[model samples]
Target: MKLWFARVAGVSASQMLMVAVAWQMYDLTNSAWDLGLVGLLQFAPSLLLTLPAGHLIDRLHRGRLLATCMAVQALCALALAGASAQGVATREALLAVSIVLGAVRAFQMPTQQALTPLLVPREVLPRALAFSSVGLQGAVIGAPALGGLLYALGAGVTYFVCTGLFAVAAALCLWLRYAHSAASSEPATWHTLLAGVRHVWHHKVVLGAISLDLFAVLFGGATALLPIFAKDILHVGPWGLGLLRSAPAVGALAMSLALTRWPVRRRTGHTLLAAVAVFGLAMLVFGLSTSFMLSMAALAVSGAADMVSVVIRQTLVQLETPDEMRGRVSAVNSVFIGASNQLGEFESGATAALMGPVGSVLLGGVGTLVVAALWLRLFPALAQRDALVQAGTAEPGGRARA
Candidate 1:
């Protein structure tokens, strides 16, 4: 539990840095497209390098690898701080630094996920995950409000503080101890890489789980465009922007804690779909609201709905994956997550540029709803399977019966 809390602190710090960057970039450029570009730059390296990083995790010590990645992330944060201090805060420089951070993330996320099973007892994995996620919520709730305050101080100071936080996170990583899984006995080859891809793509359950998140988050994530709404529509400043960023985390945190006491035990598939649908509706309400309080309320509801989806999706992934293949599979999972988030940002920015921010957000909500309905109709096997299926006990639905 202590280890999980430590990991959560690191994750929360990283998220704070990310939110700070997004808010700062929007302030600097005053352009929604530029804000979206930050996500593209930050996630581009993960999209490109995560597969290779996963392969490396399978062949290396995950603990050492995670520690190394955190070190690099710290350096990237410091470099960004230096760049900002030097008054060299060009869009290109911001994009470059973001890419460097993304490169670090490519390995870090998979290593962290794969490392968790090593740190906790099998029966307590779910609880550990919940605890880790709660810390992330803490960051989400506090970081942005603090980040926005810090950003109001100056971009350079805000980045320097983030650098310091990441440095602390690196030090924390060094304190964690875990045994590595055996190095891949198989030779590192293109065929081996392809085999990992084949395994995830062909697995109906994995594919469905990743796809569900991909489509829902891709279309439903209007939170990425918050700065625009906060500034242009709602007429709120950086602090309100931070509050907007934190709303979903608030919702997610509440739900995560509630579930810790009463975990999701049945109808997982139907629940996930319903949660996403509610998320979409919440987003639509957020998009159209002209009142500041109304916007905040709507965003909070969206956050709550998103929390439900995250729990269900994570439970599905952890319950089904094999120990040996976790690294590679988690890499694929990172790609899907990164694509949905980063690409969704790009889409939001582009659409906002073309059709105005309110219109773009509303359309995204509608699209999320459409995707959920389609997924439910098309992926009947996934829709039917509501509980984790043990390897030997997989049913026709590809999961164990609840």
Candidate 2:
């Protein structure tokens, strides 16, 4: 219960912080290229540190690590608040903070992912994950709208509110307790560092699941261009940007609640592919729509589709992995997630710079559709997968039975 609330507060704080940073960056330079740079900077540290961080997570107490990450984020928020108050908040400063966030998230994300399975029984994990998403999507829904309203007061105020939320989340994490295993004493080595990578490579279903998200979202993500749309294309202010950002989460929250009540039981693989296709279609709608309501509707549909994919992929990964390897496997999974999100933002920004925001988004939507089609051919194992958990599971070192 503490862990769940911690997730909600932590996610809310992070979303608010991101809203402020993206808006501030756009305000500073008014360049789509610079907006892309913000995402690139964040992704760089995660790219470098996430694998090693995953290894450490397997070796240490995960709850403590998560608390520490939250504390560090609080400090980051404080720093941003101070900068904004003193009128020294610049693009360079924002980029530097992005690096710190990336570094912290390298540990935070996989730790959070790895921690959940420990808290719930395997049989209930799918429902737990769906329930978890209920909180997350709620945070994602409300925080942006609140943050946008707060931004109207001032950026400094928004940062201070984020600081407070992080502090609260950190406190909650400190109270979290779970079963701990300290048995693995293997020394760090190249082979150990790459264990997660090798594990995913051997598990074709897992590989397909993660990589499908990577390429599909890499091409389909339009988040980086939201500021451009809010300002130039949609002609809505920060308030509207908040709503646009919240739109997807609104759909996601509703879908997550439904999933919690009635989880996906069959046709899991085909359902996953179809959800991605729906996400692509929604992106196309969002790219073409000039009406605010239409765009919101499209983003909402995309979010609902994404919620289905997330629940299935996360459940599949957690169920297949042993406890000892969960951190490392989740780390690899986080890398894929981070790539799809942070790197995707960079891709969106670069493409937007070249062809304009609408063109970039339209092209990405098409590319997402293409990737989904190609993946069905490329990973037949994933395509043919019948259940989230197979009847006969392989050992830790063997191929995952599909």
TM-score of each: 0.93, 0.97
- In model 2, pairs of residues that clash are none
Among these predicted structures, which one has the highest TM-score?
Answer: 2
Candidate 1: tens digits of C-alpha lDDT, residues 199-248: 77777766776788888888878756888888888998888888888888
Compared with the true structure, model 2 gives a TM-score of: 0.97
Give residue 260's error in model 2 in angstroms: 0.7
Candidate 1 lands at a TM-score of: 0.93
Each prediction's Cα RMSD? 4.1, 3.4
* Residue-level lDDT for 385 in candidate 1: 74
lDDT of each: 0.75, 0.90
**What does candidate 2's lDDT look like per residue over 324-348, in tens digits?**
8888888889989999999999999
The residue-level lDDT of candidate 2 at 142 comes to 98
